[model samples]
Target chain A: MNLEIILHAGLATGTVLLFASIGELLAERSGILNLGVEGMMLIGAMTGFSMALATGNPWLGLLLAMLAAGVLSLAHGVVTISFQADQVVSGLALTFLGTGLALVLGNGLTGQNAPLIPNYDIAGLAAIPFIGPVFFEDHSPLVYLGYIFTPLVWFYIEKTRPGMHLRAVGEKPVAADTMGVSVYRLRYFYVFVGGCLAGLAGATISLSVSPGWYSAQTTSGQGWIAIGLVIFAQWNPLRAALGAYLFGALRRAILDLQGPRMILGFVNPLYINPNLGFFLQMAPYLLTILALVIGSRAAMRKRIGAPAALGEPYIRGERGL
Target chain B: MAFPISIAIEKRTADVPRWMPAATSIGSVVAAFIVSGIVLWLIGSDPVRVYGFFVRATFGSWAAISDTMVKATPLILVGLACTVAFKMKLWNIGAEGQFYMGAFFASLVVLVPLVPAGTPAIVVIPFMAAMGMLGGAIWGFFPGFLKARFQVNEIITTLMLNYVAILWNNFWIFDRWSDAGFQMTPTFERNAWLPRLSDLAREYPIFSGITLHLGVVFGLLAAVVVWWVLERSRWGYEIRLIGDNPHAARYAGINIARNIILVMMFSGALAGLAGMSEVSGVVHRLQERISPGYGFTGIIVAWLAKLNPFGVVLVSILFGALIVAGREVQPSGIAQMIQGFVLFAVISSDVLLRYKVRLVRTRADQNAAGEAA
Candidate 1:
């Protein structure tokens, strides 16, 4: 109900999605639709939690998470790009692998807490009323890092030379290859980068958001939501930030509305049967379908900004261009 | 064109031999199991013992074999469902959701008193099956319609719908259908339950304690029907043609959109039947964990079986073994890991079926004049 509470809750929740969507956005822009984001994130979460728990260093955990996921994504690239396997099936397999690996590795870490990512507060910004508490006060350093990276991502895609090449690879791989651009290399690089970011997203959940290593469902469906956010954001990092926050807000609201209703400073419980709370959880997924349906329809009539060569493997001089 | 050595990966000019697929498939499975065995060893478990236990638990006794069949029943149905749509190049990833929808609808038949308590088992069972199929078909229709109408990606739509279906089911079970706060409906009346193999044990002692039910029969029957349709029916021709080349199929005047919807619905109906079968035969009541990822596992089944209906049956049985083995094993995730590896191997092995890769070193000194030299 209040601006400060909502904004605080929304930004805290949104950081995970933001990290994931930006990574996926980058991968998609390079013409590889990696559906294994969820899997990678889960693997990342498990590895990060394990590393952090072992070393008592959350930073090390986060790094290892990115590394593990990057390696997994490379496997995906090899299958989809080099072997010409179906992208969708390969991605799904990657997910299953990640989930299984995470479950196995995470068995020992359940109910155990690892080091938490430290929260930072800006001196001057924290002093400001309403705005300060909502934006700058008592948030994880990862949140600020995400804030800085969002604009950087936008600039990198919009202004840099490699960014232009990335867009070209996604839109017209054959044409890009003809122009001396290495489509294969660019796709491999972006897909790996996406995996790294997904790993960080997982770290964000364990180290900062939930602040502990849990079971296989720790990352839950957040990775899938992030994938949906990529389309909802129209493949734009800046817009993805907004989309993530919107989803974050919806998620936060559901949490606040359920339970004892104390989060809203109300006495009466908002959930009538308490099971009504479960149905409310369906909103984000329902919203994703609606967004895809509408976004794709608009795309047909106008440029909805999808990379033209998305999901298609580019094999040099293969036939039937 | 002669060089000291060169590496080339070229498409094979000739068609692959008939035995290649089976050979590669068996090779892949063996490779996967070996890798998983190594993993098991690394985890401090004796791989041989684990595997031996797996074999014994899945096929050790009549009861164990019957349990495996019970597990395979849904996988076969869902696998057949996926094969149909996938054969037509339609990605029906919503099978999990459709399964839940089917279960939801089937639950209503008994929960809502749609039929009288005294209704014959024969009557109520078929009605529930029909309702379940309808539910799954309707779930499939939305993504099919969207793909046909708006070109929305079916992969995303189907995946998203899965959560929606799951959450919707949870809502009902937690709120209205909870049997004294338990996350399940009350046990169905005996008349509504699918007759278990043990029910026949009254006369035959061998049938005792065998949990196998009519679902396996339904699965086998469905597989035969699917194989017949795909191999012999005119509709199968249209579906196959579209899968091979949609542009050519469209040029040939096939109604691509309608066929996509139809095939997708048919695919969903099978998955729905899987769900209904689970509730009616195995659980005998709608519950929160009605399936343990059977729908997703069915994807692996369909692919591993090469989308052949009979292959689905065989592969489903293999996967059913894994499911049963997982329960008996110390670590449940090991079985899941093997399934995942099997999928990876299956997908990667396709490259071998289509192309041949050979490594050779290119001599830089006199590559062009090497033959003359």
Candidate 2:
């Protein structure tokens, strides 16, 4: 019923997706398409919550979460990179491994309280109108981190010298190799970076955003949604942020739709018939498909596409992208 | 002083030995078990005792074997479903959704009384099977169409549709078809049930209490058919060609887009059959929690079987045992963890197929050669 509150919650929840998609964007930019985001996120959430609870330090928990997920990603790196396995299958295997590991380790941590990341409002910025409250008011430190993280990622991928090298590695590894860039090293590094960010996103959900562990439900399918957002954003961090926030708002609005019976003088079907909320629950997924269609069309029209060597294994003597 | 030892991995110029693939696969499974045991030990459980319990619980008696078989029935179909799509290099991760839709469609035969109430089992069973396949095929067609037309990624699309399909099923079971306010439809009449060995208890008292259903026969038939389709049929050749080399396949005048849609539908149909089998043979009702991740398990089964149809049946039985026994294991995720390790080991073991690994002495002469290389 309240637009402001919903948007505020949207921003907080959107931070989770923002971190995940941006992380995925980094890996894909380096010619590695890791579909293990969901698994990695789950691992992160569980690790963050449990670590915080055991240690009583949210910061240490956050760091350990990233480390755990990053270590897990190395498995993918070894398989797809060193052994030259299929990226899609390896990523899927990574998901299974991550989920299983998290589930095993996170057992009995449910309903236990943990030291969560504290929230604070920016003194002057919080006083501004709608933007002030939604963007700068009482929110987890991670939300502010996301705001700063997006543009920094954009800058690092676009304007920096290493960014050019990163793009070159993805688009034309052979060319990058000829220029003395270590394609394998960069891919591994980026994949690890992606893993760490996905872990951070998971921690955001368990330690900052929602502030508890719900096992698999903690990240739910947000990690997958983040992957979709990467496509919709065309691998751009800024656009990913936009899509993430919009999706967050949409998710929040859907939950709120069942709250009130009357909506602008019209009876809300979702409120009247609770079963109809199932359809409302489906909006985000349906929109992802719609987004994919739009994204695909745009890519075709603009002749913009995925990284040329996105899913290929880079062998030193192989004749390929 | 030079290093005493070094590892070398050289690409194999010659074809791998005939037994290498099989050896690697078996090795991977054993390795996975060892790794899972380590994890179990790390978690403070006795790995040997736990594994012992698994074997005993799954194969302890005829009844346990029958239960495992029931679980394997759906797995065989779903594994075949994954095999067909993965062979074409199309990732149809939505087998879970397709399975649900299949169950929904199968249930429609009895719930809507599509035939009259007293229809014979002969007519009604086949109708239900056909409807189940139809529902699954329909569920699969959208992602296939999207991928073929727009070059959209099938993995994400298929996965997204899974959530939609489950929710769609929920709407019906929760509100429209609730069996006296329970989250399931009313049980189907006996005519809709698949014939089981237990049904012949009057003729053979030894078969009493057996829950093994005709669905197992369906699974066996599906495996043979899938094997034939992949190995003997001309379309199978086309599919393999596309899978191995898409550009070569296109140049050979193969219609890639049409095959994509067809193969996806075929794959979906198999998974749909799995959903139907579970509903008609076991649950006997359309319910929300019918599957305990059979579709997801099927992916691992297919991979473990190396995409062979007969191999799928064997793997499904093993995994079926895992599922059956896993219910009793503590911490609840040991089986899933073992599956993950198996998959990881399997893929990693492919290194043996492509490269020859050796430990070379690196005192003086070898060290010089290594640097020169």
Candidate 3:
């Protein structure tokens, strides 16, 4: 239960969440709710793991994973945007598609280990007390990429002109249209970017964090957690990083608490009842619900600044209040 | 911008016929099959042969048909649950979790050895059913209450609750109820078992060894009851009104909050019944993998049925056939793939019913036509 080790694991776990939630944050900011993040992540993980295993190149695997997920998400955009389908149902269907496709394609790769993403050791930084060993000493380059990407995404979404347009499109597509902005184009672009990041998140899991290709259940419920993180972060990339780290810490803490302990050979267990482990594992999801309950209040939402037209689909020349 | 073969889909303002949804639904299923066929061809499978087997395995014989019904029993109940919730514009994505909760509670009644061994089947059955409903209802109440009280989004809440339910079930099965290191509880007593067709097969030669259970009958009865409620009951009218426009319903002085809880509880109760039937009628024990996404599949059924109670029954049976047939095929993903495609096609095809697509000629095509003319 060393604090440094816990923080290190927390950073690693948080990177996966960072990629997914940041991508999901982008999608939600574009007013498209992609609930298939879980499915897409599973597909991405399978593709990434298999490709990496075949080619012996994790980077190419990550790229291919992104490509696969991007294509899948484009189908979602087509259904919801072009066909005007219900976003929720279409997203669920996309999940089913992703799950089935991944399972079919990944029939041969279960339990097979792939080459892991290499971690870099900063020789000079490793000597600097607690912070260095925990954050910079030993972690995958993907973790570093997350550290770099989070702030960049934050800047892009907050400080840029196109970012303003993206927000406007999400908040009021009609008004954005009157302003000569292509609402559909912006939304599509952001959604695609979101999907790419989700794919990257999956690659992070299979290539770096877990370091193997498993079944469709590999992603477990991480994608859903990422979605909740986006809401918990109030759609802010920086806050999302913080939320992701918090969740990562909680997850790590659960494992630590559940581990066997022996003090002076007395063997006092943390959780004697095995069933309590499942209940403890529920922290992340239960916390998400708690956050949502508080976040959905009108006053909190106004303060947090949720998009006004978050889940509403936009159509050209539609008259409405 | 001039475009060639551009399809313009415009929303229709006129009233559509009552049969339009059903017609479009069939069309979507056909379209899904065609799309899946292309996928099968790409993957080097003979689509026709595969589909033939699918048909044969599901409805080729009386036994196959019986198996299909067995699968449809849970589906029908879950579909009814989805129908009720969706009618109020409430997304109860936790039906899978609620189903698990129901199964757990129902299992607890028998596994805990609460009732005596001499208890009659009639008494034991209804008690477990009630416990299952209560379990699912309590689970459903959280999201409904959160949504009504704080305007929390039920979609996320319900989805999150599913994980909680699954974990909760895992906790019990993996520990307290473990059947000597196995990830399941001991088998329920005979009194707790739902009577199956095979039970009577011993005396009647015609009904021999069929897996068909009373659950199918319960499903049919539920469909009828749901249809009556939705078509005739005041509560159903209120739910529909809320679904159409909650603001309007509230303006008309309806208690939207209370109705939300009530409807969600009712929906969860049916899903609970599905879970109860599954444990009592099929598995006869509390174990891991009780449902293979029946709750999620129910959403597809509800949508395919256009939220009609009768349609729920038929669609459930159709999906049941798919699940049953899927087992006979290589790479079992075929059934799931088709289900996914069906959902996609059905959702996309909704546009056809609501809008008219106009194919416009591009500038090049127009110029070529002008030149020809």
On residues B30-126, what C-alpha lDDT tens digit does candidate 3 reach at each position? Answer: 9998988898888788999989988999999989999999999999999999999999889999899899999988888897876877899999998
> Candidate 1's residue-wise lDDT over A179-231, tens digit each?
99988889999999999999999888888877776656777788888887788
Which TM-score value belongs to model 3? 0.95
In angstroms, the error of model 2 at A113 is: 0.9
Stronger candidate by DockQ (2 vs 3): 2
In candidate 1, what are the lDDT values of residues B1-373, reduced to their tens digit? 5545665566778999999887777777898999889888887889999899988999999999998999999999999999998898787878899999999998899999799888999999999999999999989999999899888788888888898899999988877888999999999998778889899998999899999999899999999999988989999999999999999999999999899888878988999999999999989899997888888898889999998999999999999999999987766578778888898899888887987666656655533212111
User: Chain A of candidate 1: what's the TM-score?
Assistant: 0.94
Per-residue alpha-carbon lDDT of model 2 for A97-163, expressed as tens digits? 9988898999998899999999999899999999899889999999999899999999999999999
Chain B of model 2: TM-score?
0.96
What is the CA-based DockQ of model 3?
0.53
Per-candidate TM equals: 0.95, 0.98, 0.95
Model 2 agreement with the true structure over B88-184: per-residue lDDT tens digits: 8889998999999999999999988799988999999999999999999999999999999998889999999999999999999999999999999
Worst 10 residues of 2 chain B by lDDT: B364-373
Top candidate by lDDT: 2
